[model samples]
Target: MSADTSAEWFDPDTTTFGDRLAGARELAGMTQEELAKRLGVKEKTMDDWENDVRDPRAMRLSMLAGLLNVSLLWLLTGEGDGPGDPGVATSYVRGGIQLMEEIREISVQMKLNAERLVRVEQELNELLRADDAGAA
Candidate 1:
């Protein structure tokens, strides 16, 4: 995900509307101070919203989406391709879905590979022990 927030991963099209707002805020290099200035909100208020400490009211959500230059639909539902670019949005959603499946598949494969490595290491240890015993 983008280094815009505390979250290790954030997909605007996949996260809740509020999360998308936070993510976009981060991407734009907006500090709570700067954002607050632009948004006419108190710093604590911005902080709470970003951390999910508080939910943005409906009117606030509309303002946030506009301020962040993202689509309201994407911000809220993780649906639609993106804000205004339908083609880009479609590609983004498709890629996000595909990437999730690929990551899961790789995780399973890696687990299997790790198991094989453990077995091989065990065999090598046994072989080394046999050599040492023979020498003794």
Candidate 2:
């Protein structure tokens, strides 16, 4: 847990340098041991970095950024939009907005379904009531 960052930023595409390292490992479907194996690093060294107990040197940072397909500027300063952006960040923002709109539409449909279920239940109850009255 980084004191400076939100937990929502656990993805390498959206976090500070150290946290991004952890996220990149996850995105690559790598355990710390697996990452270590690939990087020729000891697992303890990887752990130390993830835990924020140590920082990587420039060469290691460069290697990590390249390996993860992210920008050094993003990894170092968290300054840019993200790795998913092209030369400019407009497309990423547009993509994110589009995804949000999609989720909103789904949410509206879910609410409508819930309301329909309630109406169905009420109709069934009325049918049962009518049947009981006729029997009595």
Candidate 3:
């Protein structure tokens, strides 16, 4: 008899579509820009999809799965032939996946904070200009 290994596989409940898409892209060795170009989409669009800001339509989704060499079901639900489990131990893969998820979360937070900073800077600049105008 063999051991049950479901616990060691990628868990869909804990991962988002963006996470799966990004992982597949990385495993396929294609940059977001390259994948976007191949799909005839803007790089920003790809980023939006991978960042969970947007999702692609069926056609684009199919193309993405094809390009990334993953099943569409797996891409959407993480339940099919996604990435192969290499010779590495399953526990190690699980740990690595968890780390990647954490890093992704941090990166998203940083992006949001950077956007907020840009808006704050713009507001400050406007205030400064208004003050200078009032002085004049």
Which scores greater on lDDT, model 2 or model 3? 3
List candidate 3 stretches off by more than 4 Å.
1-10, 86-136
Candidates sorted by lDDT, best first: 3, 2, 1
Q: Which candidate is the best by lDDT?
A: 3
Give the better candidate number (1 or 3) by TM-score: 3
| Residues 68-121 of candidate 3: C-alpha lDDT, one tens digit per residue | 767789988888978555222211123344345445655766899999999999
For candidate 2, what is the TM-score? 0.48
Per-model TM values vs. the true structure: 0.48, 0.48, 0.55
Instruction: Show model 1 residue runs off by greater than 4 Å.
Output: 1-8, 11-18, 81-136
Return whichever of 2 and 3 wins on TM-score.
3
Q: Any idea what lDDT model 3 has?
A: 0.71
lDDT of 2 by residue, 4-55 (tens): 4433554545555667677655554468897676555789998998878898
Q: What are the runs in model 2 whose C-alpha is more than 4 Å off?
A: 1-7, 10-16, 81-136
lDDT of each: 0.61, 0.62, 0.71
Error of 3 at 76 (Å): 0.9
